[model samples]
Target: MSILVRGMHGLGDNLHQRAVIRQLMARDEVFLESSWVAPYHDLVAAGLKILRKATPLRTQSKNADREASLFHRGPLPPRAQEVRITYTPDLVRARGSVLAAMCWATATDYAAADFRMAVPAEWLQQAKLLFNAWQPRKPVLVYRPLVDRTEWGGCRNRNPDHGAYAALFDAIRDDFFVVSIADLVPGQEWIVSRQIRADVELHKGELDFETLAGLFKLSAGVFASPGFAVILAQAVGTPVACVFGGYENSSSFAGGARFSPTLGIDPINPCQCFSHSHACQKSIDIPAASARLRAFFAEAARHWPGCA
Candidate 1:
């Protein structure tokens, strides 16, 4: 019998959960139920079945603990083996991959397989067509800035100021066609400075999740704050440079540490704040983050000479 599972709400979280799902599938048939499963179509292609359901919109509340608990305790289907994965302080303190943490929490054995996803041949063709249509003069580097609303649990402190990123764009625009996929709400369009925006090819609308994944697969590299794009890029084996705002605590939580040892820049200092807090007192050093991205691009260029 197949074990039914509920997936995480965010793309990155869900991607991390794939590792756990793979481990489960090895022992029993796995059926994943999630409203936000478009990003995991690749997983479906790889043999996992999904039951689509719409996720409820999250709202800000004074009771942070209650809100957090609600997300951690996702819906459990009757008759299916339920894996109770909670994002507790203890789990965060473990400083391991969320997949491993989940396994440990449930007393299940951890599988050491590298994270993997399947991109359909058709998706590759689509990406190629899209790339050619854009006619970029240089190799493409996708950048996803932290542009979600303040109420959305994206820590404001982690978001780089416009000037810092614009400087980074100026530093690299001569060598690569930079693409910005920051999700901008109306009236907040200027958050990305004019200097950076001028240099970047803006992907304005919300991208179909599959298309975003396809673009990540085809890019020379990716640069972004820790979010869906960063995780997706890493999953597809694309080199990634990530800027961690004061939210990541890889030393404590497995999810926080999952991106470590990958081709990316982690926060220079340990972040003591909660991952979703709006009250984080610490912020990333923009100039230093920019430098790390520059180095990442340089290394990627060496390995992928075609992009140089």
Candidate 2:
């Protein structure tokens, strides 16, 4: 049997779907989008087939049935099926993590879904080269200044106050070498300008996925809105100080789709505000957020001893 699993939407969405995709690959021949293959280097090396020129799908805030139908050129072959992780309002209401939702959608064991990936040695070598060139005395903390915005998708409501982020970075600058990174490519004007203050601006959008993953492994932590950076940091075993806001709850992205009382650095939605607009993001308390970040890094230092 063969299954063509559509990993549509952003890098983050595809990443969340990786574990489920891995399960499917074990049971049947699996096909995935070509563009999405970069983050799946291990899976590709393990033999996941690539499908080129396929229409990528986004199920969030859209009709799932219609979106799933887009994957079909004709009727699927006998004993085969197409799969996509669909977002429902109820999923948010129930506070389900994307990984669990994907598992349910695919009939895969939720307990088996792991977000971690194997970083290639070459990628780490490149990151080491960049790190040595910087010559920083302090530990590295990568900052993601922008939430992803592509020609077809984005969510401004998730963006926290930039000024607050700047203040927080300044507060911690003495102890950490803050390096801000952005995904801005040749023509992504919709992503807006990178505006965060940091010791170095690696925001030229030069870092590729593998290199970025490797960098995350080398860094002390990541500071960003709840997005791919948070996921990647977790995958690489690096701590993250997530500046969460907007309509979503912190649990939607954190430990097992719920707040982990044990994890000190859960996403900080200080204001506890929720709305469809950017006002919720704007409501975050800068001082509280900064305090949380500082505490989080202090805890990270205890774990790494030499890094944070």
Candidate 3:
């Protein structure tokens, strides 16, 4: 029987997860690598065989007293009974699809493989086909200044909070089409600035793969905040205004774009958390950000054309 398992953890990331499924599907009778987890439903439907592994649940507590009562767990079902699994709390199990994903085989793996399934040639567009097809064809632009925060590590919510960011965005919105997929979406009443009361909606998609890449190519430009999206955009030859932080770019995969990384080391645990996303929250100014954005889009216009 083919064995499917997850050696990584945290519901996994986008790239790590997709590569696993893609690699496993190529096998014959061997179908999936469920990795002995419960979240294999959606991924299995996409392909890959979800197998069952018969392994007893380990005790979460190391205390002797608690360890004694760890036997309360029961065995998995028959489909699960046919296999054995290894404990991989970190989730980095792309034995074969690693090169395609373009990261080090030694890089920590994740089950949430968003990028692997999000970009690439066919994958990116196909992933968004269902969603983008429905967006009102009103010349939508992905306005993400979050990259500035990631660049310098200076907490400049300037767009709305840091300074005049909210006003700047409002000004731009009045004359141009805009939408936001910010890292943290405050409450509708939170009012980034004066609560212009703008709304951004999400639509579900059902694209195959190749189509996904096409959409990325069509984008005017990507205003990002040092995240995987920027990397993916660059892969498709789309220009990226990376609002990033820290000179040490751990997530810098294959790409060629300007790194508008933020400032500040915040030395004593700058992010308060090591994750890259948090670093960007500190930098990024509004007026300065707006000027850069206009330039980036204008540059994109030279290639995509027909924009103000």
lDDT of each: 0.58, 0.63, 0.36
Query: On a 0 to 100 scale, what is the lDDT of residue 220 in model 1?
Result: 79
Clashing pairs in 1: 35-53, 92-252, 92-253, 93-252, 94-252, 95-252, 95-253, 96-254
Model 3 Cα displacement at 20 (Å)?
6.4
Model 2 gets an lDDT of: 0.63
lDDT of 1 by residue, 1-308 (tens): 55777656666767767767767777876777554554555565566666553544331122122223322243444688765444655565563555566667655565563455766777777677777777777677887755645445544665544455555555655667777775555643324434354335554555555677777787777766656766677677777765554655433223323433244444445564555654443344667766666676877756653421
Query: TM-scores for all candidates?
Result: 0.77, 0.79, 0.42
Please give the distance, in angstroms, between residue 184's alpha carbon in candidate 3 and its true position after superposition. 8.3
- Alpha-carbon deviation at 144 in model 3, angstroms: 5.0
Leading candidate by TM-score: 2
Error of 3 at 237 (Å): 6.0
